[model samples]
Target: MERPRRWLEDKLWSSFGPEQASANLRQALSKLRTALGEDADLLQTDRASIGLDEARLRVDLLEEVVPGNERIELLEGLDARDPEFEDWLRQERAQLQAMIARAGPKEIRGILITCRVDETAPGRDRMTCDVLSNQIGENISEQVRAWRQADPDMIGSTDAPQSDVMIQSQLVHEGNGHMLFIKAIHQPTARILYSKLQRIDRLEAIMQSETEIARTVFEAADQIVGKLPHVLAKDRPETRSTALSRLGLYRMFSFDQDALREAYGLMDQAFRHDENGLYLAWSSLIRLTQMMELAEADQAALMEEAVELYYRAMELDSDNGLVQAIVSKVRSTAFGDTAGVMDLARTSLERNPTSAYALKSMSEAYMGSGELQKAFDTSARACSVARSSPFKHYWDTGHCFISIACNRNDEAIIAAEAATRAAPLSRPAHRSLLALYAATGELQKAQSVAEKMAKIEPGFSLDAMVNDPAYPVRTLRNKGLLEPVRGLL
Candidate 1:
């Protein structure tokens, strides 16, 4: 059955069942074809025989190829009633197991589709796509080149002539942003080695969408680089990309202006050098946060830029759960569109129910809509989910708000303190804590927190913040449930 040189159709079918030879073989092939989708041709078939498509399907039963160190477990939990068939399967498994023991994870060749794939995609420009292809291809090629030079055992290259492996990728508009998909394929046999999907969320009122593209390219490079070992002992451009990628998540934990400026600077260099939607998204968030310190006149202009940045990010990949939550919260502000806020919150939760950010944002939306019980339940779940996340501050803050609404002052204080501790450096976390203390008539504690906040931000005054246009959100909360303690602040 294994030998393909002779007409072994009957022998191959004999291994599976003891029935009409031709019928069973045909049935099995048909089922396999259905499962293979576009790669059904890998199971080559002729009128007189059957064989593997060696040209497109390379099966390394020996130590030859490994795709991203991925283990392909075969015939798992499979059972056969026939003694002969079961014995044959066992023999095959034993042989494969021996090969596996000798084989190591060393990537050879891969492909990168550096071309304009979505010509018909709405809002997509051919020239822009071509430029993007060059930027992305070059950066990825450099990273892999650096890695390969460090690791002598790896045999493949993305830029090598007649490379054994290749990567195909494309960008398409999705929701408010865009999504990028990449598939690695073996060249000799045209078999998909591996694939990945990523969301690029940032595109509100973007002037230079190309920057977003460059950022995502570097972001994708970081993903690939992570799977492979440091081909080089030293860091390269890919290392910088890694640092930038984590900035977005890190922002939720720490809100240091100097750190944000450094991250934004790195993002700008990378965009000028390579761009991604997420970079723009993070930049917009940082800009919005900076608005608190800007003069009132400059606030409007900066916010407009921030909105544009967000729009651009969204056009690239709106499905980003954290971005969705951020957008939802932004739209919930006094100057924001309530309908837009609700829509984003609902969609964010739909995409990721366990997302601490999404759940926290949705809970706030529920609270704003007077759904007190629902808000408390959602906030509770957010806290539970966030216990293991970097942005636990979000759920903690949500809990503080919802608990206060339910007149649960003790729980509110505890949750507020938790938020403060989770991200002590975060301005929002500190603000939430201060608000809870002041609203509950904990004048002494409020004074202590106010002093701490003063060190974080000079001239800390609740009245001044609420009156600031950039702090419309603070005003909204103050006017609503926090009305009881207005004079205390």
Candidate 2:
């Protein structure tokens, strides 16, 4: 690649004025030439522009050049303290990662989805059925493609009959309405991976229920992808990466130090293989979770890493709704950037209305801004959309906090208990339950929750938590809600 001198100055030293930027660039190029020494001739430059001799340079990132055993990042940790340069670097890294992924060995899995209208069904509108089928198919296709870990090649059509899974559906008359019976069958194993019946009361009502139906089926298919590594037993890097990512996601919610460390390692491994925006976002979320659960003294280091990872994730895939949602949560909790969190969360919801994660983040932003009513409503939506999801505890925890802030003690207790039941190993969930139990004068219940917390963290201390600025206990104390729990501890 060739770059004009002016462009280089603006990119590398935008923080400084033009004169200073130009001088700094010249000084940096002079040092680079000195370091190049014998390879100095490869650094081709003119009065107007600078270029590298691509023919002579053996760039490992290029498709033609094979990579080494050691993993290396392009210009790793080189920061010019300029926003423009940082943006450019992130884009370049994303492009390089994409190139490498295309060059690597991987498997492309496809789903052959077909919908047929039952001839026995009365008053069946072909147009309506076609529209409904297309909508559901498109929804599933979009959801699958969004998950880079799954590595879905394409949604197979009649023209392209090849597929790993066949999702067949039939629309038939039901009680005063129609029912769509859907089943996902693995092509090789001939196993039914998923089976569900979606009820549509009316042809017009199909639009309303389509999103939910697609989500249910897509999540099931995603689970199958998570287990593909075991079944295929091939050296498929993408399948292995998906398996690692799934394990990491489950472990990340444990809120235990050792489990979190293991989760981070797993997520890091997946990110290394895929280098995807979602992978980076998940890794960043793990870092933020570690920051919350780790000792206050160790939080600073985790915070720095989390911030860098989230920023890079955003830069690589700002349009990705899930990526934006994860980054928004990090910004809301770790950086306390309420304005940025609200913007990112809102955009995420706009892009993917079914995303419970975005809804939770938006609710948190509202709570932090003292918009209790908005927070409550948004939190409720989060819970509703997250129905039966394995990660429902996350939304429930947010709802518990919002309910507490709104002085809905009964609702708060319900949500807290629900969160605790959903994730028994989650310290935050236990803390929420304990807080609610204590605040409502349930001493025995509070003590039981506290005991569970102790089991999760052997060195659990109420005093330390209440005083530590890193924990949410400080916020609860400021609100005059922790005094009741303090007496029990």
Candidate 3:
């Protein structure tokens, strides 16, 4: 009795008894051998000489007859005599040569030819014939001459013969051929090299070219805006209003309040009669309001243009979460009204449960309201959503600042250290580190950090620090911060 076939017995014939399974296994093995192109004599002899159990064990022995890598060598040996293989090889070689030719003429100052010959043969006699037959030496000289003629700026002589030609050859006893190596060097005068450098000096010529292309586009846009005022003061009030509303939106970035006012007046004129024009006017008003935070206003105008833009944007696209979120942030920050902002934030969170921006906004609102724990929770959620977000620095730095504010110096130091590691280039991160060092009575460390900040922004000064908006000097002083560095300042 013989052992059973593992795959056939376990999977296909597992339900059958041993004898029946063995019979099925034999039939399956026969089909596989025929499909694999095994000779009938070898298959029958092996099958007949062994019992079912023994034959199953012999399968592993038969598998080693053809190794994977040797199969390719065997295929190549057989292909050498096949006409189909010869035609295919010729076609592939021609395609490769064509591709090389398409790359165009390349400069060749040296040539290397390698050949293997019978070691038992006379070395000098074998090399003499091989050198004469090989066209490699001639091809290299031609390439060098062509290259010199094509580019006169190239550092080489066109008419002179190669100054040096070196050859190295190797012989293998078992192989039928010898290995030959050749190198050729072209010589040129030193003056040619200097000329090449002079040709490259023209790269700086671009600085003389005028940037009129960019200036022309700006001038055309300005002309269009200038014509809008006349068009808006027309009989067709609706058309005029639409033009004015568009102009108002365009003037938002211009920082020209007079132009903005003129555009606004035209928009207002259109809004009185055109509902569609009202939305545009309102949207422009919101953008303008957002830009006014740095203006001379003592307090941010909450009931003014920002709210109007939000309402207009909502009217145009009620489902736009981005517009709703911005509007909510402006209302909360400008008016110091967190209740409405919190509710809007929650709504935004419901829409995009995993949004980092929404989470960060919620955290900011909490921080604004002096709700430290809530801010931390919201910030943690934002970090979970986007660990590598630049906003993470904002949250981490804010957390550190809050810790400092509460006189938790150790906790503040830990958070500040993490923020600095996360974004070393961030000014806020360095500022936090400076504050942490100063609070911990590390004046030298604070000064070192301040020096780094000064290197990044040369205008960073103690006088500028006194009026700095991001982290004010008064706040630093009140927190018992920068006290040690006061002498350095």
Cα displacement (Å) at residue 320, model 3: 4.4
**Runs of candidate 3 exceeding 4 Å displacement:** 1-326, 405-407, 466-487
User: What TM-score fits each model?
Assistant: 0.47, 0.68, 0.35
- Residue 202 miss distance in model 3 (angstroms): 67
CA lDDT, every model vs. true structure:
0.56, 0.69, 0.46
Candidate 2 worst ten-residue window by lDDT: 142-151
* lDDT, candidate 1, at 95: 67
Ranking by TM-score: 2, 1, 3
Q: Candidate 1 or 2, higher lDDT?
A: 2
Model 2 gets an lDDT of 0.69
**Candidate 2 at 466: error in angstroms?**
3.7
Give the higher-lDDT candidate: 2 or 3: 2
The clash count of every prediction, one per candidate, is 41, 0, 11
lDDT string for model 2 (344-458, tens) is 8888777655556667878888887888899999888778767666777877877887887888879988888888889888887788778778888999998988888888877
The prediction achieving the highest lDDT against the true structure is: 2
